[model samples]
Target chain A: MQLTQFLSRRRAQKAESRSPLFSFLYSRKIAPYLFVSPFILSVLVLYLYPFYSAIQMSFQRVLPGQVFYVGLENYERVMNPIFFRALQNTSIYVVLTVILLTVLPLMLALILNHRLTRWSNFFRAAIFIPALTSVVVAGTIFRLIFGESDQALANQVLSFIGFSPLDWRYEAWTAMFLMVAMATWRWLGVNVIYFLAALQTVNNDLTEAASMDGANALQRFRHVTLPAIKPIIVFLVTITIINGFRMFEESYVLWESSSPGYIGLTVVRYIYREGIQNNALGFGAAVGIILLAIIFVVSMIQLYLTGAFKKEH
Target chain B: MVHGRQDKLISAGLLAILIGFAFLSLFPVLSLLVASLSPASDLMRYGLAPELFFSSFDLENYRVIFGPEGSRYWTWYLNSIIVSSMLIALSLFFSSMVGYALAMYEFPGKRFIFIMVLLVLMIPFEIMMLPLFQLVITLGLIDTYFGTILPLIVAPVAVFFFRQYSLGLPKEVMEAARVDGCTEYGIFFRIMVPLMLPSFAAMAIFQGLISWNNFLWPLLVLRSNDMLTLPIGLATLLTPYGTNYQLLFAGAMLSIVPIVILFLVFQRYFIAGLMSGSVKG
Candidate 1:
């Protein structure tokens, strides 16, 4: 190793002594670009182009290959009654789901991360099953559970408790609540895993020091644990809000339409139904832009709330 | 963090509350299984009873799920496996290649490219669902397995995680290889990739779980009933045949089996991948 290093060094010195340009040519700059080219090519094709096309298509009218620009009309149409209902439903979905995503997972992390639990691993794997199960099947199963009869699980259970069996999905509010339950079931474990991972990074020293000073459990969590996992909390908050807007499949499964009062509906489903099913491509893109605007606004709110952009907390 | 017996009881009480949350999480699924297995005779006999498990057990549900023409369940099971495996293979190579480019070299727009990837990671695809579906239509990718697999292949999150892991690797290893007149591609392929085995495995497991479970995009694109993936197919089953609880539960059970197996085997890597992209293995 020493001899090889010595020879390489001597050769490099000789090359350097001969010509500076020779050295620059030897240390070529093209390698990085070469290594990174494939990735750049893919991003342009798959991501950047699709995004650009969405904005462009939202304004253009396509008729037998000739295109004409027709802007604000699409947005105007979107401001009508149907879109308003979807927008209202979208807001409700976001608010309800964000709560479930934050609390269920965070609390689950606290429980599962505890040293006192002997069956933590079992619970972890079991809880994760809902997330791992094919969403289609989960949707199918849930649909059956909410079917009109006392045949449905929720109705059956309620009936057994002296309440009459109710048609779960026929009623709008009950259907929305059930949708929230489905979303919560499928995601709680994945979020808990993230929180549990962050929990590991919580400084034992800080917690111990707090306890040594006779601080109680809630005090320690408030002063130490919560602050420590603040970044993860922010991330979870961000994702929950984003996912809220993205929900679609279960709604389509539940309601079977792009109709008014899609209680199980969310914003993404509206776009899919508009663009694909209804063939109103321009109108759908306008709706998508509106959803995007909300997501971006919520993200900024989170950034302001967490103060992470300030580097303080 | 210290808890006296009273505090322990209090925390334990809180933990039980969390357990109650867990039970709430588990209740619907258990009840699904309960309702599915509840015989038509029983529903006909007592109507949907809440205390389902305490009431009875039956193998009829399992039998219905396994029967080929008995339900459309078998077809959905087969479709899910084929499509998910194809996605797993496609993403492993594509993401690794993307990761390799970001890891092994520097270039103009390197920072811009990285930022673009981060932005993509943050912006959920539903925002662009309209145009992307339009694009897929133009490409004639609808109802095809490649259609389902193609969009998710160029994931920005995988690249971000890989770049993070790669940046922490010692630079001199690549430098030494370059000094030896090894082509940059050769150095990356031979040395860096072999060393990144753990990350590759980690990502493969992660993407497999995702692709296996994905429903929304597939639902939008796949029109023919034959092209239906498991979730889409399962949804269709319930619409017509769902009144038969045994067959529906049976179908649900089959969809879960392969995923549960994959999880049991790869749960450790699955857990670790979610935790740290930086972990070596």
Candidate 2:
């Protein structure tokens, strides 16, 4: 009551002593612009300008202090066999990682969310500890663990299981497996967090109703929990796909310089090699533009199929 | 009785599976810690094996990192701290302001700005790094902290997150503040910011982890030895000549300490904030 009276008194005197400039500056019309200007200016200068320049550079041949308009030559050059190999490898990694990350984390989240589960918080935090480490750190450790020597942890495990040790990095499938495994180990806990949060939103009464109707646990989850968390699933899948396309540090730190035979070369690694290492900025920018287009198209299609664009009242 | 038995059996199986996964998740870090502690010669001879019983542990690697040889490591560590701190502070302040403005005020271009945020969020930094590198060079910000922090200081993810978070805030307090003769700026800083503490805490950890573990952009911009961040510096240890397994292991182990502390401190807010961003979006 006192607060209300104080507010009323202040409101009564609100516009009393304002000069014209002060009134204009403090008006609703101008306040939002003031609040949003910093973000707008940064976006314009930093993001949009660089994006525009990337488009321009994609059509030219860039050298230090000189640029030539080569008119699609750079893009044409980026369409070679090496580029195709990177695309194929990246696509395979993306497909495998996305599927594994989504399905595995969902299963884990389900397990953790079980009513009788003990030490769920401990397990969650333990699993999440890996996500706190940098990719470089994780990649470096994985490299040593999966090293080509017989003494490496992976080989030791294999030999202990009565199997011959395999060179984990030289082959295509094995290298892809190693990359996917590293990504899963790092990301699984984080995804579980997403799933757990989504699971919490599933209505308990609805699940209880389904159970009362003689539905088994799987049936209840399928009919009740899955639909409730469908949005979160879609969001995770989309971002995972995006992250898959942007896979760089994993492959880079694993191989240290270059993946042998380019077996693990990702599209971003290709960009870094061409643009930064090899000094072919135009070609790199062209690849980057292609990657951007692919991600944009894939995301739009995924969102559309998932009804992300559909209006919800 | 039969149904209850089956349920217990299933729960037991699930518990077993969760334990296995949690073990798998932590095994790598345990091995890394072990590798960091073991003698470098043993690591080189055996290649980070699981048999930890026979090896002698020592602090030689950590001592080297702290000694004169590891002075550059500390420099990189300090650089990462400065960059991540500045990035988190500036980005949260500005991004939250924009988010608040969009959420609370009925302004022109609000939808356009929000759309722009989404578009920027979708475009991966890898695509932009090439052109951004050129811009950094042109602006003479190469090898500087400003260049490293400038492009990402107003991250679109943070903006979108803050915007989503701000929408759920109570508006009655703002109305009261306004009637109480508070200016719009005064209201946001004094009234709204306190309400959005959870969002800030969440974004801080999220952005903190990103900037701390960031390798590519910082690698591109920070050319000097002293300017490199922890990830970049640790990465350079794996030169083609030979790998510095000892320093690499110890440094990586230490590199994780700050973030682990941050996570433990803000563990609740981190997950809650992440959920709010995705679930609402």
Candidate 3:
């Protein structure tokens, strides 16, 4: 009887101290959902809904207020010669840029990791400053640097080196070269940072052991460092490819979307022209879907090849 | 001693190469600064020739940009600040909440939500822009700040980062808080939030950078001059006829200042954030 009376008094005290609002809010079963509902709501409205709408829009001819289903017509139109040209151009850019991005930064990171200079941090920071600048800014500066006149900096450098001045944006090849140069300049430092971080985790003792086993410096690097940083390399390559597909700002700023004969046009640039500029929403949706398909397939292949898909038990 | 001699020679060579690369990397940026400083008369006559050292340098371009004629520039900068601050706040609040729930609770649809986050992370903004533009139009958010920031407020990257970080947090403390009659929100706010300072700092920088540098989406939605962000405003300066190279260069240089300041202040967190976010895959 004494224990029961004490328990009842304690329960009454607990109830008196709890506010109704606090009790409602503190419910474990309900609180987690409330905490997470905002994100879930955003995902549904922003991502999932639009994602589904894009697929639906791809099948229909959408006007300002009217929409009608047109069954694969948009996809068929997206396969026109212009789309093919974009696909081919983007593929070329991806291959060349990926190679340069992967190789150059790896070399820079390896040298920095060797502690060759006391100013490594300063150099890293300086190189990374460009990466911070917006593509609009970088593109504008590059345009001026590679401007049309002989007085331009790039042309001046060429004349100084005894080479004739070339109009960089006038020709398709030269314009493409300018795009690649800008991308390499902007992204090299970012990739170097990635490689540097990965290098920090690499086991130095393994390298020393390899050297002691009569391995040359080149052999040691190939055997020790390359394998250790392979995952990062693969990851950077995939990003480079993705960036290559989405190469809008670089090319768009270098030359307008409607550059001379569509020489510098990229896939995303094409989408911008057809969709926003031309008001062909259905067509744009179809192109976006195609681009999505390409990226999804290539990324899955990348993951598989890099063993990124390997299940960890 | 001979081995030491070889090592010194190799180091010297490597240092020279690194220095050369750094010069190459910074040359264009330096040239942009030089262009911004070039006198308006020189820029008008000589046409943005950074190679021409004989031209006089002045801050007249910057003066013009910051002066009365540059009200547009200031407006755009203010818009960016407001948009990015709101973005950082909203993103940090909701993403961290969702991430915390994912990490702590075993509710239904957790795996599905996690997978959705990952899928959304892989889908670049360009792929989603068309339909998203349509949605924004339908919602009548065009020309509004909320429209500019709404779609990106709950960044999948932030959610993933917070979730990964929270998975490492001590679960025992949460259990103890429960036993002490503390509410779930109370534990998260009073206990877990204090523990998650580094993650918050990292996400702040990342989200801040994205919001500040975001261009393509803002360009699409923001039509009015007053509502324009910095990137879009600067992009308009590069018109096809009679481009104002001096003003443009000055504006570009000014645009980089805020981000550089952010980097200088939170560089360690920035590097930590990048390393963890990038190489973890």
Q: Which candidate is the best by DockQ?
A: 2
Comparison by TM-score, 2 against 3, better one:
2
User: How is the predicted docking of candidate 1 categorized under the CAPRI scheme?
Assistant: acceptable
* Tens-digit lDDT track of model 2 for A84-196: 99999999998998899999999999888988798899999998899899988898778778878898888999999999998888898899999999999999999999999
**Candidate with the greatest lDDT versus the true structure:** 2
Where does candidate 1 clash, by residue pair? A136-B231
Assess chain B of each prediction and give its TM-score.
0.84, 0.93, 0.93
TM per candidate: 0.87, 0.94, 0.93
Residue-level error in angstroms, candidate 3, position A205:
2.3
| B1-281: candidate 2 lDDT, tens digit per residue | 99899889988998899889989998898888888888765564456787763577888889988888788888989999999999999999999999889898997798998888887877788888898898899899999998999888888888888888888889898788777677777788867898899899988888888899888888889999999999998898754355566678788899998788878888997786566458465
- Going through the candidates in order, the fraction of native interface contacts each one reproduces equals 0.43, 0.70, 0.52
User: What is the CA-based DockQ of model 2?
Assistant: 0.61
RMSD of 3: 4.2
Instruction: Residues A1-313, candidate 1: write the lDDT tens digits.
Output: 5565565566656665779775654454765665556567766777778778777877865544676789787778778776777778877888998888888789888888876664677777778778876666666656656666765566766877889977677677887876787888888888889988889999999999999999988999999999888888888888788887787866876666543455555677777777777777777887888788888998898789778688552
Name the top TM-score candidate.
Answer: 2
Error of 3 at A279 (Å): 0.6
DockQ of each: 0.35, 0.61, 0.52
